[model samples]
Target: MKKSSIIVAFIILLISVGWILSGQIPKKIEEEETDSSLNNITDNKIELVKVRTEKSVSKKFNKLINIQGQTKANRMISISSETLGRIIMINEKKGEKIEKGDLLFKISQDELKIRIDENKARLSSARSQIDERKSKLNEFEIQFNSEKNLFDKGLSSKSKFANAKANLDSARSNLDTAKSNLALVKSELDLINNELEKTIINAPFDGIMTTGHMEIGEFVQPGSVLANFIELDPILAIGYVSEKELKSFSLGSNAFITTSLNDKIKGEISYISPIAEEGTRTFRIEITILNKNFLIKDGLTTTIEIQGRQVLAHKISPSILSLMDNGEIGIKIVNKESIVEFFPIDVISDTNQGMWISGIPDTSDIIVVGQEYATIGKKVDQKLIN
Candidate 1:
């Protein structure tokens, strides 16, 4: 009975110890679970923020601007004579449409014709002399051959054979001289004919002569003003562009205009001078304007406006266009999180309504109202005002 009581006491002590350890185990597990739940909640708070945006592919814009210009002629050239002679026959009258190789004026026979005739006679005489020399040389050669055979056969003397040989050599030398003289005379005749041909002046281009300075029996030399020829259908409108606005235009830029008397006229930049004019410091530009209806005229006053590309669709109060934080002028926009981002855009051109700019997107939703209050990366709700 004493041993069983001792065993029962030990068992009671072990049960109390186990019950206390079990209570601490449940508390430790609950504390670990609470700490893990707090950690999870803290980790979940650290990652990504919410962003909301709407996106859609828009239709491509075909932007057209109104540019002003004038109609101009393509090209104009004056016809001039290459030879110095009097005008004998005026083939085409003034205001006549002529093509290439058309005859204009013809001159009568002058000293040039006489010189050509003389050269031709000289050439014919020289040819006749050459023919005579050839015949004479042939006769001398036959005689020389006969004498040489006789001398070889000891029937003719060496003196007679030498005389025949000398006569043949003389004929041959005369023939060569005649040929050279004929060649020189032929060349002279060709040059005279060329000069005679040049006496007839022809139209150098396809156009109408505005004014004719000479008539029949008029003596004109090279470089003399013969006629003022100009292209009839189109005319030239000359103008100068400012040096500051040099970069505002380009070759082949769009230009348009309308006259009070004429309809709408369209033109493109045809020429831009590489060097600026010294007096005006302005670059000279030529635009090829068309005048098909025969409306445009020379020396007509015209207004020209070179068109450039447009930029920026954001609307702003006209007051803020020139506003500056310090001294630099710029506009501010909002980032993804409604943060303000200020950037400078050189105002290349501006109208009474709005400003055109570069270095900006084609379309931007700018923060015009709260831009002064916003900072970069500051999150705020954006009001859709477009």
Candidate 2:
């Protein structure tokens, strides 16, 4: 009786366990079916990111290389004194415009004039002495010739012939001395005249006197700075170009310049350095522009724009620019299949309206709005923009 009760209790425990498992298995299956239905509905209702796009039409653009530059005078020189003298007159003051051959300064010509006059008088005396010496030499030569003829015929004494020859030699020596003295006097006169010319300093070229003008009573020696002279006509616009862009530049190319004062002007490329600068590795360039009115000043900052090769580019607002996973700057566009695509671009130039860029299709639907939310290679709902 005890063994029968133990077997019956064990069978009752197994039956309770099986019934509990059977009820739990149906409930689990119903929950899984409900989850499957929800998943299907969610997958079918998936929506694409909506983006605002504009059809960008590429146009022919003249690519430009903009360079920061400065205006420089074509020629800058420090006018200096060439002779020692007291400044007697200042023809031009500081900031005065002058022309070539215009008198700028005048030194005391009184002393120079006196010296020149003295030299002239000495020259006259030398000439008179030369003439007298020539006459004496001619007389001595005739006498010596007569004496030699007589001596040769045994009609003149040896002592007389020798004396005549000696006198002729002395006269010739005196004549040579007089000629040398005359040359010396003439040279002295020439030197004095040169000094007189230096007393009146004239402008070497048409320019403006910037500084270094001395008072009338001030003394100046040779090599003293007289004035700062600069030529403003045909001024130079100086700038540097990178080594990579140097090949694109050529002599006589047209360039547009804008000064710090907002002066717009045109120029031509005049010079290009063959060797690059040491530290910057850039070549110096000079553009020549006419400054007839002298409006442009030296050292004024300027912007130079040089035209490059023509290329097809699209103009887009800077806000639409995007970046790729690799950190490359690009723009996002929708292809024919409505898939978002990233295109790497080269910025050709920028203006007030937008930036011009290249390296894209001739016509593309660029996602201007909602580009940040759009993923590359994913379909997007594109909305056309005006």
Candidate 3:
């Protein structure tokens, strides 16, 4: 019986050892499961990313004005003749530069020269006649004085004195008439000379002449078209603005213009038409474009843009616009529970900077990147992008 008891004890001891070993098996399995779950979490973290983002708010809405326009030279003109005469010499050819008062044509001066010479001869003869009349008047004056002295001395008759005085007066009047006649002839000659000179045409301003109306010896009438000329160095851009856009445009506003002909011009508002067109309800605005290079030609189609509207917005790359679930147009935002939140924004203006949003806090930090991946109220780790 003692031996039987000893065998039972040995069996119990073996079973105890087996039980202890069996207990370790569950712990090992639990440890392996924990390690596997940790690995899985790490791998999932790579699949999703936190997109950095920013927030935008609206300040004040700015209005934009758009307009269309054409270009023209600042000064353009057609020359004309002042009198009817034959063109003697043509100084300027087509496409020639001319200064102000530059002679463009001359007329035949044969008649004018003869008229000038005749006036000179008449003036000389009038001077000689005036000298003779003056001498006669002087002699008559002396005779009248002597006759007056004789009458005062009672040695001459009153009739004789009166006759001497009358003679002096006549001579004086004749001399005056001759001098007046000479002056009139001289003035007539001057007027004719001016009229003759008017046969020659001259440039009224510095410009380029496009055409010469008459050749040498061609007779032109007064007010005939001589040539087409345009003043250089400054040009004008004529544009029309809608009535709504005219409010933003005023004198001195900066503007830019680009033409289809590969010319870029910039200028400021030079004029704004006071009256609006009754039909189109549009107003005219002008910009004086500088032509320093002399490369810009007239009548080029152009585009104009105005700056400084005082807009408040966020600068996002154009790619940031996205679609939201339930089809509501909104951007992803952050929530209290490490979750994503989305809200619709009132879009004021979409600009090169970004979308100007209303209904968002001015200080709200928004998610800019990875907005589509995270759902509303879903847990996430957010990173900031300023």
The top-ranked prediction according to lDDT is 2
Alpha-carbon TM-score of each model against the true structure: 0.64, 0.76, 0.65
Model 1 TM-score, 2 decimals: 0.64
- Please provide, for model 2 over 223-338, each residue's C-alpha lDDT reduced to its tens digit, 9 standing for 90 to 100: 98877889988899999998877655588888889986856799999999999999999999999998887888899999999876677999999889997768899899999999
Off by over 4 Å in 1: 1-78, 91-98, 110-123, 148-156, 231-262, 276-282, 290-294, 304-320, 325-330, 346-356, 368-382
Model 3, runs deviating above 4 Å:
1-54, 57-66, 307-386
What clash count does candidate 2 reach?
A: 0
Worst window of 10 by summed lDDT in candidate 3: 307-316
* Candidate 3 lDDT, 10-90, residue by residue in tens: 999999999999999999999999999999998885444466656554455553444578888789988788776677787
> Per-residue lDDT tens digits of candidate 1, residues 88-163?
8876557666665677778776789888878878888998998899899899889989999999999999899889
Ranking by lDDT: 2, 3, 1
- lDDT accuracy of residue 238 in candidate 2: 94
Candidate 2 is scored at a TM of 0.76
Candidate 2 residue runs with Cα over 4 Å from true position: 1-58, 148-162, 240-248, 259-262, 273-284, 306-312, 332-343, 361-386
Full-model lDDT for every candidate: 0.67, 0.89, 0.74
